[model samples]
Target chain A: MMSNTRTAIGVGAVALACILGSAQLVAAPKYEVVELAESGTIVGIVSFDGAAPAPQKITIPAGEDVCHSDPIVKEDVVVSADGKLRWAVVSLKKPAKGKAFPADDPEKPIVLDQVGCRFVPHVAVVPVGRTLRVLNSDGIQHNVHGKAKKNKPVNKSMPKQMKTLDLTFKRAERIPFVCDVHDWMKSWVIVSKHPYYAISAADGSFKLDQVPVGTHTVQLWHEKYGTLTQEVTVAAGKEARITFVVKPTEAAK
Target chain B: MTIQKHRIQLMAAIPAALLTITVLAVTVAAPGCATSTDSEPVADLSRAEALFVENCASCHGVSGDGRGPMASLLQVRPRNFSDEEFRYVSAPGGPPTQDDLVQTIRGGRTMGQMPAFPYLDHTDARLLADYVRKLRETGVAKMLVVEFADDDEIEPDEIAEIAEERVAPGDPVAIVGPSAEFRIDTERGRALYADNCSSCHGASGRGDGLDLPKDELGNPIEVRDITSGRFNGGAAPMEMFKRIRCGIPGTPMPEASALSNDEVWQLVHYVDLLAGN
Candidate 1:
């Protein structure tokens, strides 16, 4: 029992150390499949604490008619009429050894379609080892560029009507993707190591079900507001509720 | 004869089916090969935004509009980050990635108004990358793709005219003249440069950096001879500051992302001295 505790401490320390450093990637321990008698659910609401910043208007200054048809209103900070935030990502920073990503093949590809000079579904969740299928639905040219530190970066030109390009991330990462041709066409693909992640709905509510009962670090990430982290404990067969007050960091518009 | 015709038609469909299969195979295999770095740290946007104002605002403008106080007197126009399109990016023949921006920052454009910031730590460079992406996300800045009909087709005269008007198409910004108002401390500039730069750029600034690359036959490939000071980027003090901070891309010079902006300016002055300005 003492040896097992020490081994867990060793793994936890390594994971925490990787999380704290910027862009440092540590080898991850593979998730193991296990039978569990009791599991708890985590539910959360992520709300913006301040006034929503105005939508930025995207205009093509140089390649005018050849690019976008009209000025695109960026959905950076979309708040519902009822004050629910949309597209904010919530997930476990690092899960302890337990349920193996729920799905047998976490490697399934998540489709990201480019339509009307914009990315369909601005924020998408993809399990690590899963593929991100990027399809261009427009007739014009679009270049898919990825800005990531831990994963190999992607900058490929997608000729209109070409078959979809599959992007794979080896580690759990939140990658910001952009179309250089449109410039204003931007989105995110959050590649996770486990299934305990969800994007806040149009109503700003999110839940992570069947999480193994234990304490875990929860992280909330937003493109405009930045990130916030919290520690929550899970009881057997119980639900833990959380509310994240997201404030814009200096990166906020 | 009719039976032979029917069989011929059926055999002709095989290539079409095979073509579809080939496309499908290529399509299925492409995503498995897409480049996605998973080990990178999360972006720290706050830090990036702060640095952009302090280091990049003079040329890139506070709003990242590329209309800083010193707009003119430059041979190559400064990059307008707010524009969705960027000329220099990471992957071959596409828009710049975050790493491309980082590298662009590290290696100042060889023939543009941008400069190197080799002293910067990777963290700060990455933060700056995140900040730029924010501008893209918020739609404050947009870039236009400049699709040439064909590079070989454009005549030299047409190219020269556009080249002469390098800053012609950008959004209107106040054309404040050269504002490279750093107190030219040539003495300090010379000292700092002698220690760090002399080894690569050489004592006389002739670029006799001992290790010049040679062809298979052992002849030296061209290196920058700073005495002429004809950088692909401009020679403005601010431009020099950019080069110092970012370093010339595709060159031995590196970005000093860690260096203070003020220090970069001093090096710019020192480089001017080397150029006999």
Candidate 2:
């Protein structure tokens, strides 16, 4: 009788919570692993349509011998002479069912290293549940402060003697990291929920393979240009080609 | 029928009397560590919210955003509970433990701006700490929604889940003492300070070495003046040890991870001497 009374009292609050939860609160289907007979591919060129901005050099704090070895520059906008953009993240948006994330190998974990006071590979993608092994190769004092919203943020101290630290992200999001001592040091680790994600190369080309045959929304995101999406249909055993031409002015919008 | 009714009433009254005695007994026994279980969550937050508004909202703001009317008047600003990380956390990169929050509320910081509220009992302090924790969790959730507006959609449930996960405190950093054979050496500590900390903290330990450095929130922060003898973190030996070991979160202060235990002790001694302890 007491339990019944409690349930009756909670019903209204439960209803109100559900109402305020989301507009369309339908649960997304979980991804499944299956033997693939046929799969589709997505290939794209995330090119810059306008003249790429000149790379700006960041002034380093004086007195660090290792950091002073090389000049650090702003890596937000990396464009080749022919206007090919670099470091743009591209992914398929919310595929109901597709491929499973890659199996984790503890021996060969994904490494994010601090070399010469800069994060190598300004942008990296790690599958959820996989570990990111952070190394301080500079052998100097540094901290890896991950600014994560979905995952727990980590601000581990990497003193000169400490060589390696490992981190894992449970949720999918773009987490930026920085060093408190070195304010200019920054990097991004995109924890991917699915396998259909790729970072554009120096030639501005990216490819997502093993996608199920369907019309899927493709999202291209850059640190500066923001995000732009395009829809394309994928055919089984065949590749779908698309191009995302980003303009400098689109960042203003 | 009258006899049966009396028996039922007597049975109920016996239990009621026993419950009253138990409540009184517990209340009388409650003191420092007895009533303080920092890990336990409060069942109801209504009273806690009311308490926060009455005592803390003047400086911390009703929303805990650190923009209270008195915030601008204070030389050292009250911490924005929602937006900023707690400076005195023992868990590196994790949320503050309930004890950390409760102690800060009860004792306040050593700095003059945040005064101690000794009048509030331990239970009240715990309630306010729980409320402040909620504010931080809610704030992180809101921040996520805005940050990922362009990227992926985070549902309400996911937001709650993420916020809870992000704010969950981890194990406290281990505190160790100098080795048995180690001896205090202020001269070595002074040399270490010159090599490691002097660049930002100044040669004289006066916090005059560099221009105002930006914190994790990108806000310009004043470096702690060690010579002034007042530490935002407490001046106890262990407090100074933890501060150096973990470093202050969200600040430019780096942990003395490179230094050995002996070296840290030496530095601590040197700092104490500089502060005229």
Going through the candidates in order, their DockQ values are 0.01, 0.12
Position B43, candidate 2: lDDT: 44
DockQ-derived CAPRI band for the predicted complex in model 1: incorrect
Candidate 1: misplaced stretches above 4 Å? A1-33, A60-71, A102-108, A249-253, B1-277
Tens-digit lDDT string for candidate 1 (A196-240): 789999889999888888898777777776656788899998999
lDDT accuracy of residue A42 in candidate 2: 96
Cα deviation in Å at residue B252, candidate 2?
Answer: 3.2
Q: Alpha carbon lDDT of residue B191, candidate 1? A: 69
Candidate 2: tens digits of C-alpha lDDT, residues A57-163: 98886767999888888888899788889999889877777887777778888889999999988998898888899998998767788877677666666766678
Those runs of model 2 whose alpha carbons end farther than 4 Å from true positions after fitting are A1-20, A23-27, B1-46, B153-155, B187-199, B202-204, B208-212, B254-267, B274-276
- For residues B33-77, could you state the per-residue lDDT of candidate 1 as single tens digits? 221112222265345555776787678755455676675656655
